[model samples]
Structure formats: C-alpha cells, structure tokens
Target: MIRLKAFPILAAALVASLALTACGKDAAPAGPKLALDAPLPETIPAGTKLVIGDPTTQRVVELNGWDKDLPFQIEWAQISGGPAVTEAFHAKALDVGSAANIPPIHAIWVGIPVKMIAVRLRKDHVNFPLFELGIAPKAGIKSLADLRGKKIAYSPGQVQGEVVLRTLAAVGLTQKDVTLVELPSTGDVYPNALVSGLVDVAPLGAGVATKRYLDNYARDGAQVLRHPPYRDDLTNLYVRAETLHDPAKAAALRAYVKLWARAVEWQATHKAEWRDAYYVRQEGLSPEDAEFVVRAAGDPVIPRDWTEAIGMQQSSIDFLAKEGGQKRFDAAEIFDRRFEALAAEAAPKIAVGPAPAQTEGKTNP
Candidate 1:
C-alpha cells in the first residue's frame, strides 16, 4: 500500500506487490514493470482509451504542460466531486480519479473495486489544520460536543462526512445523536451552506480561514468551532483495478503520479503563477482571495509508501462501521501498490517517531 510519514519509502513496490499477491488483482502473474523514472513507450497500442476523471483541473495542467506530453492519448473527463467520480468508476466510465481519503473507503464498503494509487501529504504538517468543522456564529454551538441534536452537513462517502462521525464518536456520541443533512463532498458548498443557515456546522478546508474566502462570513456571522485536531487524511489518488491490470495503463498511471509531484512542487514554488492561473483566471477569485489561497495551499508532499495512511484508513473504516452504520472491510484488500516504486523514487520525507505540528488552500474537500 502507498503511505507517507517520517521515512521516505524509496523502493519497495516489489515487496508490497509480493504481499498483495496473496489476494486481489496483483496476485496473478505479475504485470509489466512500470517505469517511474524513465520515459514511457513511444505510443499507446491502437484504440485504447484511458479515461481520467479529474475533479480539480490542476493535474492536467501540471509543469505547465507535462500531461499533454504523455506518451498515450488521454480522454479527459470533466467530473465534479468525489461522489460523482465514484459513480463514474462504478459505471466504468472512469479509469482514474482523485479524492479525499473517505471516498475510497466508502467505495470498498459498497463493493466498488477501486484502489488507492498514491497519497499527497500537507507540506507544513498540521499545526493549523487545513480541514475543520465550522459553525455559524448564531448557531450557538461552541464545540464538537455542542453538535448533539443539531443539523449538520454530511457528504456521505467523503472525508468530512467520516470526520463528522469520528468527531461524534470522540465525544462518546453517534450519528443518531444529531441530524445529518446529506450534501455532496465539496469545499465551495460548505461556506454557502453555513452562511445561508442551511446547516449549523459544516466541514471546511483550512483555506476557508483565509481573509479572501471567509472574510464576509467571519465579519458578518460565521465562526469555526474549536475542537481537537482531526487526524491526517491525505489527498488521495485512485485508479480502477482494470486499469492496474493493463501494463500500459499502469505505466501511464505511474507517470501521472510522478508528474503530479512535479506539478505540486511547481505550484509550491510558483505561487504567483498558481494564483494567476488557478485562482484569478480559472476561479475568478479576487486578487486578495487568490493571494490568501496561495499562502494557505502551503507546500505539497507525496510520501513514498502507505506506512502511515493504511492505519489512518482502518480507523476511518472502523469508525464508519461501528458508529456510522457502514459495513466493515479490510484496508489491505482495497490497496493497489504498483506505483510505490515511482513515488518512492521521488524520495519523500519519512518522519520516524512523532507527528510534527502545522495546517490548506480553502474550504474542506
């Protein structure tokens, strides 16, 4: 499985694959080796379509144009959010998708056969925490415990929805203790939901804390509730198992991960460009708002392996099954790790013992 922490997982895909062979897709005779550091084959075999569902447009624009230069032809699909992306996967309309940690966990429970390919960690760690649950100032809710009997937004299979359950569990409560208002998993929807009083509290990404995004809400009436920091839920990348079985698709997926890291590093270094292209130009956000997002996006890091992410997911699954009433499933069975070699080749930092402190671009995703 792919994970990140103190130790950089440099080269362990073979070993991880060995473990995967005991069960699941990789158990058959090994597929062709995916080249992580080298250029891909000159062309994709005739008439093969690699459909990619990119919720965020950033991936296709990496390195200014790396994706456009890939060896294979990409049939890019414009998808909305995680839930829609999951639906695309189930319908076989999508071969690859990216989302928060919760989406895949829910997919597995529902018997969708997708696998987590790679994970992106926050560069600053979580001192401020990019993700949080927020409340309206007049909602009269001061903390997590106050959520009991209140109506809150829930994005069924996404990160925030699961976090809502975990937050309830942390207080020795459950979903029945509060009313859950189901909503799609998205960052933009949360603030509007909170401001309109559609829901008392909403899951938000840390970027909402920036002046540009949250200024009106904060100045008028919105306030984020204080609570213990939620555990690290990495921005996850997922691909279909059928794609993994195809050597060409696996190679393309590997290249995509490597290029993604490059793009994240590029975004980190070229803050002005990121704001210009993504924020101001694409989003039509004000200059000030764009600046706030750029600063808050912080740096991005991709861990070489799933050493830390798996346990985080297990806890998520257990929480959902026991508290959220979702069926249980093993974390290992859902992981496809052929891309570890590519990510490990990038050589991301590995924290040895303890988690350091820090905290996002905007509202929770």
Candidate 2:
C-alpha cells in the first residue's frame, strides 16, 4: 500500500510565495551556458521566466530536454496537483505547467482565463489503460461491469476520474450503480486507498501502476475495465489568455512551442536512452518497470496540427455538460489555436496530419 506522507502545507505555501516574488524581480545572474546540440535562439527575452511545475511528472519534456543540454533557463516549481497548477496560473506564478483536461475546461466554464497551446502525450495503449483502471487482486474486479455496487475512489476534478466515469459508461454502468468516493488529491494516497481496501478501484498514471505491479502490491490480478478509444489524452501547455494577447509574450509563446517540438523529436529518436537514464534513474523505477512506463507514455511531442489533435476536448466538454458539471459552452471558444497555427507556419517543413478521433463509446451511461 502507498503511504500518504504528511505534506508540509506551510512550507509549500512559503515556497510558492518566494518563487512568485523571485519572478517579479530582475533577472538572475547568468549561469553556465547550456550544452545543447539542437539549434537554440540567440537571445531569450528579458524578464522571461519559464515557471514550470514538477520536473519528473508534470514537466516531463522540460526535464528530459534539459539532459540533452537544451538552451533556456527553466524555473521549476513543485505544485500539488491540477488544482494547484490552475491556481498558480491564475496568480501568475506559472508561465507553463501541466494539467489534466477537466480543470482547464472548468476554468473556461467559469472564465478563469487560459489558453491551451499544445498536446504533450497520448494515452490509448495498454500501459496507460492499465494504469488508470486501478483494478485490485482481492476485490475480484475483473471488468467494468464488476465495478457496479463497488465503492470506487478518484479525485473529483481530475482527468483520471473523468476517464473512470466515461469508461464505466462505455460498459453500460453509471455512477449510480457504484459508490463514488471523492479523493482529496490525485497523488499517492488515492492508490493506497485501493490497496488498503478503502476503495475497490483507483486511477493512477502508467508509471505508478507499473511500480505497484512490479512490487507485488498489485498484479495482473486486476483487469483494465475500459480504455479511452481516442489515441491522445489531452495534456497540453497553457498560458494566461492575457499573456497570449500581448504581442511580445505571444512571440515568446510561439518560440516555446517550437522548442517543445524539437525536444519531442529528440525524445522519439533517443527513446531508450531517455527511458533508461532520465525516466528510470531520476524517477527511481526498476529498468523493467521503466520500459513499460515509457512505452505507455507514447510520444512526448505535440503533433503539428494540435488543434485537431486536441479535438477530444470537445467530447469532454459534451460529457461535462451532460453531467451538469458545465453549462453550455462553445468548444471552439474555449480552445484558441492561433499560436499552434503560428508554430505550424514557422515550421512548414515538418510533416503534420489530421488529429485522429478514436471514439468507441457513448458519453451517456
């Protein structure tokens, strides 16, 4: 069972405050030059702070790219979860951060003011599917149908919860058929709740699922109840709408996407190297487990036609509306594709394709 560590709330609050204060000040002294083989811009604009969330999980691209010696200084900060990252974005404490599809959509429903620029990873394969299902051995929960009448736990506003709910509907089950437990956070504790029998099922990332399986904490004993038919799970880079409106910041935003694209290309070519060294070594996963996890992560690069790639956001919006989580809202209005278009215009030589829609089931239960 995963133990829930007592998070130092005061410490985290202080750290976030200090980091925001630092960004408000003048630029820091020049540090050692970055060693990078990829082409980098000659000058980064002054007062530019690439405030990133956690390195290993949240900002996987930035963390891995740093090892390849990519140019640019990234100010890494630790955030609690999607909600914290969203809060930071609102406070101007973050420039780029990672969040699930739901919070950002909720933000737009309430006018929180952010623009999603690109998609980072896709999850439709075995690893990602197994990870989110949160099946347990002793529970005898073999499929989505078995979850009926069971108490299932998940973070209320997290992407995994939405996936769980949608997965159940795919198998003709609804939230009413099962007891839904709202988790306080999407971190380690939610997984522990499953192992300890507090909840029959929980949602987790591929990496965490792999680790638990390898440790005998959870095994093939549980089955993946349902998998998202769409190949890409929307995980993208977002900036304040205000930031995107400014011409200077907008230019920088385009540059950031270009750099991100280059980094994704590098990750694809050197998959094994990154999987072994950075993903395994830094995250402290076993080599075998790491391989499974990396394979599950798919490509870290954003597709050239990101707007089309992230069309799943529309389906999610539809689901939320039906579930009463969101009132009627235009999917096109919530998603701003101008920056992605700008990135494509600048890198016209890159091959891009229509975003694939792999829907398999209905949203209604």
Candidate 3:
C-alpha cells in the first residue's frame, strides 16, 4: 500500500540496490553518446522492448485496443507512485515509470539520474484538485489559521506532505507552529489517523477516500476544506537516465510515448467506457464512485510546451528542498525535452475552460 507521497522516506534503501540490475536485462553495448537534443529515431527496431510501469495507462491502452500493432514488445509492470517506482529504478526494474513531479526531483536528490519524458495537467485544476484538507471530528478546526497547536499528519516524502507544507505556508505558519504527526500516507492511514484523533488534519486524495470519509463521518462533524489553489497535478512519464542511453529501449520509448499520449486522449474522449472498464470493472469501485472519479478528474491536458510545467516543478523543488533541508538545484536539469511534443501532437486538443462552482459530493462543501 505504498502511496504517492512516501518516496523520500522509503528511498534510503535505494542506494543499496543500485548495483542489482539495469531494466532487468543485460547491459546494452554502449552506443553513440546520447546528447540531450538528439532527435528521436524514426523507427523502433525489431527486438526492441520496454518494461513500462504505468498501471492506469496500461488499463486505458488495453481497453481501447491501443495496445495492438506495436512495433516493439512491451512488458507492463503494475507499478505506480514514488516509493515503488523509485525502488524499481534503483533495482533497474523499470524503463519508464509514471508519477507526479516529486519523484524525479527526489531521484536527482538521491543521486539516481532520471528524466521526465512527458507531462499531464488537469484542466480546471483549481476546482478539481488532487487533494483536500480533511478535518477530524471534534478537532474544532475551521480554517488554516485554526491549525495552530493541532496535530497534522505529515509524510515528508509524499505529495501529501508537500500539501501540508504548502498549507502551513498559506497561513504563515511553519512546521514548528503545529505538531507534525509523522504518518505514512498509505491506504487508509491518513483517514484512520484523523478518525482516531491522532491528527487534527490530513490531506485526503480527491476521489474515493474524500467521498467515503465525508459520507461515513459527516454526522460526527467531519469536514473537508479546500487548500489554496496551487498546482498539485503534475503527473508525468519518466525513465532512468541509463535506460535512455540504450539504443533499443530509447527507440521503443519514443514509440511508446506516442501510444501513451493516445491512450490518455482515449480516456478523456471516452469517459463512460473508461469509467466502466477501469474504475468500476478493474478497480472494484461502484458505478457512482467510478463516475465521480471520472468527473472529479476534469479534463486531461498534455501540453506541447513545457515552459509552465518546468516552472511549477521548479517551485515545488525549491519548496520541498527548503522544507526538507535538501539541496536545491534547477528543476530543468531533470527534464528530457526531446519527447515533450510527442504527447500533445498525438492527442486531440481539448479546450480548458473555467473551474466549476460545484459538483455532486459532500466533500465539496
């Protein structure tokens, strides 16, 4: 049950595993020096293979029949989030992995070279945030200012931890102003912590967890509050630097990026089918919950440009580094822009409209 925001703490074991393997394959013969600006090869050579670790995209690709007629072989690894993906990279077990902006930064900090190959942002992201601040019943927390002297759940390595830091900053309060109850944000840990009064507030992810927390405890005065509008929806497809150095895998990755973009587009265009096939059928969520998950996601936007994304990433790196007492470096160092345009070119354009006023859920209140 490793969650999205726990990579930093879990990464202590990474250095020990680096010498294990490289993409679970024999090291490829060294090829021509790979310059950052080198154009992607036009063709994926026969026998090219990639062990991708994107479970959600895998579901979408399979459901839309987009997994067919590929030039190279794909061995999909059911991996997501930072902890597992980072460990896989350390073990050389993954070629391409999907995660938020934090993992790539953590990888750089921990001396594991990796690069983000593609990026995705939520349209109308302000309203459809990835997380919300959940207040424990009887904690008597009403606003960010009320957080003083209250116990807050913190996972320094995960995005939830980032949210906590950002939330504190919004109120002009530092970590010392409140009690940080260090808790791993995995499965129901945060919710359980709040329910048991172990923490006064915790950042709950938007979909199922937020919905259920409110539904089951609203009678006891449980409440969900919106954090300040900040960009927390930086999802990307990244790979270890060594993987891109191999000619065969690089070619396969180029091809896979295009298909990956199309799969994202497929999910956006065919929401009902995606909800049924992925959220309901595969994830075991009810029809109503599946629909809510899809709606809460708003629209997915794969930008042709990386300017704004890199800026957001840099901001996150600076914030996390300051909060966690880690080294600060230029965020641009972790991005490989060669494949930046691939996703935008492959996917159909969707207009990003204004944020909605409301949605059908108790969590919204």
Candidate 4:
C-alpha cells in the first residue's frame, strides 16, 4: 500500500487534471488592489474563495471569523485532509490550507512550488502532550510493551502515526510486534473502534483522547509517546511560491497572517467564547475536552524565525529518511521561508512579554 504521506503526489496530479479543465487562456479578472496603509476590508475581493479541509473545528471557526474581518470576499471549501487540500492548492482552488510537517515536505521534495507563509499551531504548544498511545480498556494493556501482538490504528501520513512509530522504536518494538491499522483522523472513528474492540491500541490527539477517557472506553492509559521534539516546527499555512511572487496575493497573504496573529490573541483572551461556539456546539465535545483543546492552543507560539524552524524541519527530514525509508531530501531546498519573513514583518506590533517562568513539574498546556 502506498503510504499516506505519498498521497499528496497523487492528489497533486488529480489537481493538475482539474485545473486544466477549469481555466482558459483568457485572463481572469483581477481582485482589488491591496492598501497596506488602510485597515483591511471586511470582505475580500468578490469571486475570491479560500478552500480549506475539515474546517469545522474550533481553529477553523476562528479562521472563518478572521475571513469575515478581512477586506475581501473569502469562500471556504471544506475537504477531508491535507492531501485533498494540497490537491486544491495544485488546482488553484485553494489560496491557503493547513498541513502537518510531513506532507508539505513530501510535496516540496517532489518539486511542487509551494512556500510556508504562516505558522498555524504547534503540537508542543499545548501544556499537555497532543499525541499519545491509547490502549483499549478491555485489552489489559498497561504499557507499550504490553501492546505486543495487539492491533494498533493510526492514519499513515499524520504526525500522530509518526509519533506512534517512533515510540514503538524507542521501546524496542517493530511493526511485527503490533498490527498496524491505518485509519483516518483518530477524531473520526477511532473512539468507536476502541469501544467496539475493533482495534487494540492507537495514537490519538488530546481532544479525542480526552473524550474517550470521559466516555469510559479507555482506562489506565499512559502516554507511551509524545510528539517527537523534531516535529515541533509549525504546522504551516502554505501558498504557491508563484502566488507569493504575485503582488496582490503576496500582500493578501501578509494581511492574512496579521489577521491570524490577532485571531490567536483573540482566542487566548476569549477562550470561553471559542469553547462554547465550536467545541460544545459543533463537536459535541465535553467541557473537559473543550478546555483541553483551548489550553492546548495557548502555547504563545508563532511561526517567526524561519532559521530556527528550518533546523527543526531538518531534524524531521533526517529522521524520516533514516527510519521511514523516505528519500534523503534537502530540508532547505524543500522549505521556502521568504513568505514567513514577509508575514512577520507585516504583522501588527504586539508587546513582546517576558517568557513565562517555568515551574517545576509543569507540563505544557
């Protein structure tokens, strides 16, 4: 079976096919010119759309609000995963999309003309860890070693699965030691799978894991893994390098990032609003689960400092090449940081506060 990370290449090919059918040689009408000095308009240029994947979550809700606050028309297309979003990007159907660290690397390695424009969120930003090994309560599993011969579920291309594999390796287990089942996002059906005994163990995000714990499907579970430190780089917002070169899209991207930073700050200040609006109403998640998601989002993180982010990317690339049998791709060649620099410069001037004092035994949000 082809790996999940490799799906973007296939998705991109599909996108190319779609793009060829959508546009003719006639020049498309242009959007309004950006006015950097003036306040961003509440609606973007008419006929402009922004396609996103699985955007019903709290983060997307916040982003959608930001879109309304912008100066132009913003249309959103909700797909399933990063690969589909990538396909949209390839087809020119999407202006921006959220992606984990790996698939973008895969796209870049394949010579796709994309650049990381903004940092969205990081796994480590949360006070508690995001990814963890979850064992079914009925399985009598107590530790990673106990998972031997048990079935495990994870999405192949996702960072959670990467964490699971690394954790297994850390504990001296291999794929042979546990049966690996490739699922979509753990938030989708892994909880039901666990409750129904379809899978013995799985790696899951904190929100879903919290829900499962609250639902009583899993018990005495320990975090057999954490997001690998190497993967701490931002899950970025990407645009085509060609788009960045366009003065309109480039300026819009900068404005978008500025709005994004404000959105993050807004979420931090009004956590309760986001919790009620999205997690409770939309996701039907419990209060505890919602709180976990909110606090996890409060890590005061931004995607500035591309050189440092690139160092983190290099570590992940090296690990993927060695352990994942991925080709040795040059990290610098794959990552275009110019957009990040531009966005950082264009962002609003917020007061830089002192770093939070670390307390003993404090785990990240």
Cα lDDT tens digits for candidate 2, 1-365: 11212222323574568456757432323443322111222355665545666444334455554424434455667764566666666566766666667666766654566667655544234335424566665778766667788887754455766776676777788777888776745456666776777887776665555456436664536443445554325666666665543443444555666665555556566778878777678878788877876677664434555555456677787875676445656665644555444433433344355432321110111
| TM-score of candidate 1 versus the correct structure, residues matched by position | 0.77
Candidate 4 residues 1-365, lDDT tens each? 22544344434554565466446311333654433222323334434333334254326445455554555444444443555665675566666666666656656544556665555554355445555566666777765567678888865555656666776677788877778877765234666666667887766665556555545643444223344333433566666555543344544555566555665556555678879877788779778778877775544355445555666667777765666666775666544443444334433343132322431111212
Model with the higher TM-score, candidate 3 or 4:
3
lDDT of each: 0.61, 0.57, 0.77, 0.55
lDDT of 1 by residue, 1-365 (tens): 11111111122342233234323333332546543323333345543446665635454365267565566656666554467666665556666777778778777766677777767777565664556777865688866768888888887667777667667777887667787887764546667777778888877776634343357767666676534666644777787665566656665676666655565566666779778877788778888888877776666666655657777787778867776556687776555554544553443332122221211101111
- By TM-score, the best candidate is 3
Candidate 2 residue runs with Cα over 4 Å from true position: 1-15, 18-44, 54-73, 121-131, 219-232, 342-351, 354-365
RMSD of 3: 7.7
lDDT, candidate 3, 184-293, per-residue tens: 67668888999999999999988778988998898999999999878889899999887777767777887788888888888889999989888888889899988988
Tell me each candidate's TM-score.
0.77, 0.75, 0.86, 0.73
Alpha-carbon deviation at 205 in model 2, angstroms: 1.3
Q: In order, what is each prediction's RMSD in angstroms?
A: 10.6, 8.6, 7.7, 7.8
lDDT of 3 at 163: 86
Candidates ranked by TM-score: 3, 1, 2, 4
**Whole-model lDDT, model 2:** 0.57
lDDT of model 2, residue 277: 74
Q: Give the TM-score of candidate 2.
A: 0.75
Candidate 4: list runs displaced more than 4 Å: 1-49, 52-69, 90-92, 109-113, 120-127, 219-233, 285-289, 296-298, 342-365
